[model samples]
Target: MTLSAPPVPDNDLMRYLRERGSTRNFKTDPIPDAWLEALLAAGQRAPTSSNMQVYSIVVVKDAQTKQKLAEFAGNQKHIIDSPVFLALCADLNGPALACEMHGTSFHGQTFEKGLVAAIDASLVGMTISLAAGTMGLSTVMIGAMRNKPLEVAELLGLPPRVFVVFGLCVGWPKTSPIPKPRLPMPAVVHQERYDASRLPELVEQYNRELAQYYRDQNRETPDDAWTQVISDKYSKPARQHLRQHLNTLGFGLE
Candidate 1:
């Protein structure tokens, strides 16, 4: 039994929830320019930190540009196949300029501020995905772009204080991605205080649920359960170096 795509969102709020699960396979269809503008505009409406809105997006449509981005994104085939690609960046240049124009110091440009900008960028990225989904399009976020941030920055001609948090692949999905299994609310959600006593049992149940979801859909991934997948991801020693690379790209850790 192939897991069905979550039902089409029936209402505005539920529509947002149902419109999740990224799609990679895309058809050879062209996205209309007007709708493309609207999707991006919707992202602008997403909430930001103190309305600072320290985020920017680089929309890529040219085949060569997309191909270069694909190479940076670990050469994901769908990236090259997709009709659009948007690289969301955490930007501080605008604020820096604002301060300069007002002849004021921007002392808040600290490590904490960088994190806030990145969070705002991530929010914008997801909002774009949701915006695309609402317009009958598909999206797949590519975090692999961080695998080579310096190269990506040079390609995008970014200035200092601007960092690409992640890249989002947008297009018409050839096939709907099945919903990934998630831990139940009881397991993930804690009531009044932080609770961990039930964690082991909850994780066990979630692992079982994940394994069966694959069998139900007749699909196969690298691992069957959440534990296995997460373990494998953290298993790599090179993962730790990602942050050092970010520091090299103009983000001050201090």
Candidate 2:
């Protein structure tokens, strides 16, 4: 992959969207402390559910720790090579303890509540990615943290009622990866009636477009484009059912 300067930001946010790509290669240059701080600050500035902010970010920087995380992520080298790795967690311990200290009872820690926390953490994580991109940094989201939820929780020293939601890699880009193809706008957006009438037609057009995109990039052609990919995904062996796992981790999915 060859590197290239970012496209200048034009009127319609084209440059911002075009230049952003998941970067895997990173130079050995040490990331500046202020830039790291700025990234975290941008994450903190993102919206939270009811301002509870029941989430946390664990910075993984030590070589050994990064290796451990990388191993957990199926030995994805980028996890270890990136200057920083963040384990975004959904946390209930903070609010629970805060309530305990104040002699106040908090009963909103339901499965839905946990969902909100996870969403908040994810939103913050993506904000960091955007902020990093704006500053010429690169990033990749790691959903593989859920591969071994229990192990990740132990590695991060997460307390009861706190669990790893996802991971992220952040660093300067080494090369410019081409932007992946996306479905057309109309395929996603809907008006008041929630019109899904155009789905079949839209899917067909998108499949053709995506196949062309793949061919242009010299990538292998997908069998049936988006729909087939999604069908195959669900057809695969099931992943860990989080309900029971959450029981051990202190999330009452009831």
Q: Which candidate is the best by lDDT?
A: 2
lDDT of 1 by residue, 68-129 (tens): 88888778988899888889998988788899999998754478888988999999988888
Worst 10 residues of 2 by lDDT: 11-20
Write one digit per residue (lDDT tens) for candidate 2, span 75-150. 9999888989989988887788888999999764587987888898899998888888888888999988887788
- Model 2 residue pairs with clashes: none
Q: Rate the local accuracy (lDDT) of all candidates.
A: 0.82, 0.83
* Alpha-carbon shift of residue 49 in model 1 (angstroms): 0.8
As for candidate 1, its clashing pairs are none
TM-score of each: 0.89, 0.89
lDDT of model 2 at position 40: 97
TM-score of 1: 0.89
Model 1: how far residue 113 lies from native, Å: 1.0
